[model samples]
Target chain A: MNAGHRSESVPNASRLRIAVLAGGVGGAKFVRGLRQVAPEATISVITNTGDDLWLAGVRVCPDLDSIMYALAGVNDAERGWGRAGESERVSAELAAYGAGWPWFTLGDLDLGTHLARTSWLREGATLTEATARLAARWDLGVSLLPMSDDPVETHVVTEQGTMHFEEWWVRHRAALPALAFEQVGADRARPTPSVLGALASADAVLLAPSNPVVSIGTILGVPGLRDAVVSSSARIVGVSPIIGGAAVRGMAAQCLAAVDVDVSAAAVARHYGARVDGGLLDGWLVDTVDSAVVPELDSEGMRAVARPLYLSSLEQSAAIARDALAVALG
Target chain B: MNAGHRSESVPNASRLRIAVLAGGVGGAKFVRGLRQVAPEATISVITNTGDDLWLAGVRVCPDLDSIMYALAGVNDAERGWGRAGESERVSAELAAYGAGWPWFTLGDLDLGTHLARTSWLREGATLTEATARLAARWDLGVSLLPMSDDPVETHVVTEQGTMHFEEWWVRHRAALPALAFEQVGADRARPTPSVLGALASADAVLLAPSNPVVSIGTILGVPGLRDAVVSSSARIVGVSPIIGGAAVRGMAAQCLAAVDVDVSAAAVARHYGARVDGGLLDGWLVDTVDSAVVPELDSEGMRAVARPLYLSSLEQSAAIARDALAVALG
Candidate 1:
């Protein structure tokens, strides 16, 4: 798996054993591009379940669901999140009970996935099994996996009380000034067997355009995973979540600032820092808006490619993916 | 706390310290009636939670919710269950995932109660605390209490296998031939403190027309409670669940048969047996349909009176309560 470019294990190089780390909406959109470009690849999405929480007793895995909905072709295009043809009656009722967590509008249709996952988890099934079950239900061809089966919560430490990632993001609308980020229980949570296998056997690895601090950060925070990826020979490329100076979605800028990192694509690449300084990634995909940072990336001995990353449709996203992969392979 | 049929310690004979042991539909109906007739009475309903189950990770206490909705004046009278203005959108979603049992329709609004209860339970709150929280939300006047805070499931030994009560009632639609009934965990379950206090302090205790085998029997099966009721100084009156040869609601006749009892009002009284015989009841109210059973009840040294037992409406139910209370006082 350690070629520092693309491993030649993918079926015809047309079908790559591609593993992607992702969070919610932006990550999901990038994944949609990945799927469109590499339709024949055995894509394995390692979704961050750090955003997962028991909301009104249902296990709501926001990132996992977003990936699933996107891959299954059922994501709501207009709302930019959740399943298509969704209803929020359950959420409305939940709100009426003064459980007014307004930012995370749990669509009634989306609730089915949550209810199934929660039920199975309660029935002694691990989160891995629950994710598999949900994926099976969606019939999404690609393998979708949670980073771990164990409880690993992302908590944002703010001037206020250290709150859960969901509370920080959804309930508070990510309004609180984040001081730091901690993946609670991640020290004890090992990556699931499939996650390790997917990474090990991958032709290439892509980091979706998710928030670096709480999203992809939580995934990498899993003990031993960073070292495994650092040692792997596969090409590692990440699409920048930051465009110019602002985040594509969520509070990535705030997250970056909380971690004392500059809010720029170059800074994000530097924060990842070649995973032991040239040990994690061979390439980084930055948006056209960050074309100025490409020279700096090359100076750091990492290949940085500028792309028109404003994903307007599946076709545009596929074109971006093709160009990014071509640059990474070269 | 004892007087003739009223307790002097209760301080209000007109405003009775009325304690009721209840289950679902039938019990909830009787509670609605009690609410109407004795609006000023301190009504404490000790509801059976044995019928409670975790469906799709939501804690659904059928008996508790029935009593709650009935007391709140928002029960679906026609279906004899669930909230009056309920919607089954959530259930349809559950069905879509094939997660539902296909028997019970857990309406979205009704599901809010379950979700809240389950969430509370997951947070380490006892069933008693959760029940109090739910009741507080509905602003119910009557003090609704679960029979015990501990886990107690109503299990039915049927020809196929021992199934959960809901599985038996809903999945099979009571079509399976029940061979026996077991109050699982009843041996270890202790009555909630409020239940014991209500029994100890109550002037008159009413066993509403709920199924004796599963409903009232489950409460009686809880180790110390039946003995407490038997020994209490209060007048214990039981309204016949079996009006004639059939139950007014539910398959009470079927339940009685599972416990090897006949399907008559006389049979139901005999099942409660001479606690009525031993002067536990100063009064026994039978439906006019079973006026023939009154002679038998009178011969058993119990004061037997006939009244209309069909709870067709809240007003009619109040009339039944008035007559039953009058019989107890007589």
Candidate 2:
């Protein structure tokens, strides 16, 4: 095992409930590690819905699906997202009909999840309820909860015009320098009851290494979600998505730059700010390569820890999870 | 060739303007033959949209697609419908998600047509406009017009409950004894300007060998369509779907039985009645096997002719079309 400090046999380990704030692939991988390390602990995941959009008349929640598929062990490990053994017949057909973004491909098997979710939503079920129904299909160890039931699409304002976050990310490959990220409907979105309850009663809150600006930031932007994490007695710890001054996966650097934050772990920690200074994070975890900034973070009233944060495998991911929990517990 | 009197070399054959009222498979096959026989003639096909339904949030126009695919030479000859070499990955996924009818198999290529139609409809395009756009993708050689731009669903009232025509036809295989076929929204539906114009200006109007109760019957039920045909100067000729006291394809027998009409050529001719007596048909063409009904039909003010009406091949279908035009002209 690659775990530097094994916490499987730690006292009250089974009863330690952790709530995770996650986005898509990166977040899903981290949550998978957290589940493995704390097998007995009740893990509640609040997923970002800002990336969600309606494609070909079907409601597609990319982040929720990625997390669900990863937890269920059905995710395409090579592609880093979507289901294994997937077919893109539906997506090809949709494109032939000029229905959705021709650049974005939806696998046939993945479309089943979208169709079911859209049907339930059309039948008056909330996003949270539909997610529960979808989760029931697989033995996901974590309780998956959407940040809010209301729609909140992330629109990226570009030099040409405003486009959906998915269009900018998947279509343009995020090459279009985003001027800003507009969380449409986020102002009116209220945190679901389960999300609020999970935050209020959780032992610790761990923010996954997702895009801080679009993923974790969008979740925090939901009405009353960030305030709940701030007011609760639980220690909130966030793992830096940027490692060695570069994003581990996806275009987090572009997103951070759009918000005028330096693409470094220290700058990200400061961006979340210290809980003592009316910010959300009580602790911050960064890669050992950026260990020089630990004292600077501590001086800024935010407890910081440096560790091997590369989640190359399940064991390596579990080791990172252990370090985050240790920081939160301290 | 089974044609009694071939008219391919007849004068004014290329200039013959024919309007056909049609349904799905049987009608599409007949139209395919008509196009082959009179390549230069202007053939206007008014397709029934009664069998159309919204499946998985996509508007599926079964009859229109059947005709389009057949005329484009992409139809599965063996299945008598849908695109050849098509996959059902999308349909299988939809079923797995419990989104659409599990029993009804929608081929991937067929779903492309539905997606296109639905997308266009959602973007403020009428069904007529969408059909025109879809038809532009294929050199169908004939103009395809929907009976009405408005929605008109065929519902079957069975002993159990009133169900959509697709549910009765596809799911139950039409085994359930239907009390009546309700053309929902037909009363409010008006024939498109093209439909009325085609009927008014046509030299000959032919009724294809489609389902009488649901196909031709439903089209006639559209508020002004039957009236337009009735008031037109064109000679109306109908080719019987029934031969040797049974329907050649589909569940036309069940539909006829439900409407209290005997499953025979003579009975169907009577069902349409004579145009002179305020009915839809001026000429009724039946198979030679049902020759005994000719005198009875003639006595009933309908000019009836007995010939080979089976369309087993393009040559045979063209022969059938020739007979229909001859009857209209006689």
Off by over 4 Å in 1: A1-14, A98-105, B1-14
Per-residue accuracy of model 1 over B189-280 as CA lDDT, tens digit each = 99989999999888778889898989898998898888878877777888888877888888897898888899888887877866645535
Worst 10 residues of 2 chain A by lDDT: A1-10
> For residues A1-330, what per-residue lDDT tens digits would candidate 1 score against the true structure?
122224322226555688888888877787777666666778888889898887877888888888888878899989888888887777876666655355667787788788888888888999888888778767676788899898889999989889888888877878899998888899789998999999898878888788888888888889977766665667788888888877777799889999899998889988887743755567888888899999989888678998877767866676666665665555
Position A55, candidate 2: lDDT: 78
lDDT of 2 by residue, B71-136 (tens): 988999897778999988777766765666788888877877887787788878899999998898
The pairs that clash in candidate 1 are: A1-A233, A1-A234, A2-A232, A2-A233, A3-A233, A4-A233, B274-B277
Give, for candidate 1 chain B, the lowest lDDT window spanning 10 residues.
B1-10
Score candidate 2 by DockQ.
0.47
List candidate 2 segments past 4 Å from native: A1-14, B1-15
lDDT of 2 by residue, A222-327 (tens): 9889898887788999999999999999999999999999999999998999999998788999999999999999999889999998889987887788778888
Per-prediction TM-score to the true structure, in the order listed: 0.93, 0.95
